[model samples]
Target chain A: MTNELALAALGDPTRRTIFECLSDRPSAVGELAQLLPVSRPAVSQHLKVLKDAGLVVDQKVGNRRIYRLDPNGIGDLRDYLERFWGCALTTFKMKSEQKGQE
Target chain B: MTNELALAALGDPTRRTIFECLSDRPSAVGELAQLLPVSRPAVSQHLKVLKDAGLVVDQKVGNRRIYRLDPNGIGDLRDYLERFWGCALTTFKMKSEQKGQE
Candidate 1:
């Protein structure tokens, strides 16, 4: 479920930029929108997508909501990617074994 | 490029299952289709999606196309997930720094 959400969330280039922007520090939608080419509401929409994807978390800091990366969701993606490597290694070994027979 | 393709390739559950089937060893579309709930043509289509995603490759073996995982594309996914961890740690440190200031 998390993987599905994450893959969908990260499927877009604009959303990826917004998500990556918070990597340095958490920021308000307006602040982030300033750096991005998209409008403020579009950034807000992207934030919602990231939130749904389980890739970001937000908190009310007085009047504005500050967005930050969600470590758990990120961990899930990392684990997903890790499995791909395992698949690769297994495939690699099987090929090597076949080569040995030949 | 590979990340986009890999994400799109893995976005589907049916394709994911078919790709996972080849994790143990390469197999023909018919053999994989037997293990899957989908039809042989469906399996062939899934393999084609995986191939386009750069997630899997195929070779003709005795008139059958044997599909295997592509390691380079997998490495790209692994590297993509690895960046999320970097983002996480950076966000963690920034939060810690803010807490210390407060």
Candidate 2:
């Protein structure tokens, strides 16, 4: 469920951009807004979705909230992809052997 | 660009479902339609999108086209995720040290 939500949240182009930005380094909403073409409020909304999906986490720094990519979430997403990677490779090997027999 | 296309291709819930099906094992349009709630035509459409994104490959078996996960594309996507994983970890370590200093 968490992986599905993370995937769904990243389905949006803007959200993906925001995610990539966070991966580069942690930043506040204003910084993200400056980096992207979207407005501050739009960035905030995207961050909210990301947070809800567990893809990002925010820290209270002074009066602002700094956002960064959540390592645990990224690890889960990576593991999900890795599982498919293994499955695909196994299928490929089986297909190749079957083709050899044909 | 390729990774972006792949990500956008998988943004849809139906597309993700189709991808998961392919990962389990290669199947034809009819088989996929049977397993999924969507119609045969819908399955075909989703396969087209997946193919266009380089996420799937099809083989002509007799009169049927069998669809399977493209290992190359999966490798690319895995690499992309791995890159972010490394970046996030590095950032996490840095943040911890910085916090220690404060």
Which candidate number would show the highest DockQ if scored against the true structure? 2
Off by over 4 Å in 2: A93-102, B93-102
- For B1-99, candidate 2 gives per-residue lDDT tens digits of 777778878778899888888877789999999988889999999999888878899999999999988988877877876774687777777878999
What residue pairs clash in candidate 1, if any at all? Answer: none
| TM-score for each of the candidates | 0.77, 0.86
Give one digit per residue, the lDDT tens place, for model 1 in A1-102. Answer: 777777777767788778778877789999999999989999999999899888899999999999988877787777776674586676677778999999
CAPRI grade of model 1: acceptable
Could you tell me the lDDT of residue A16 within candidate 1?
76
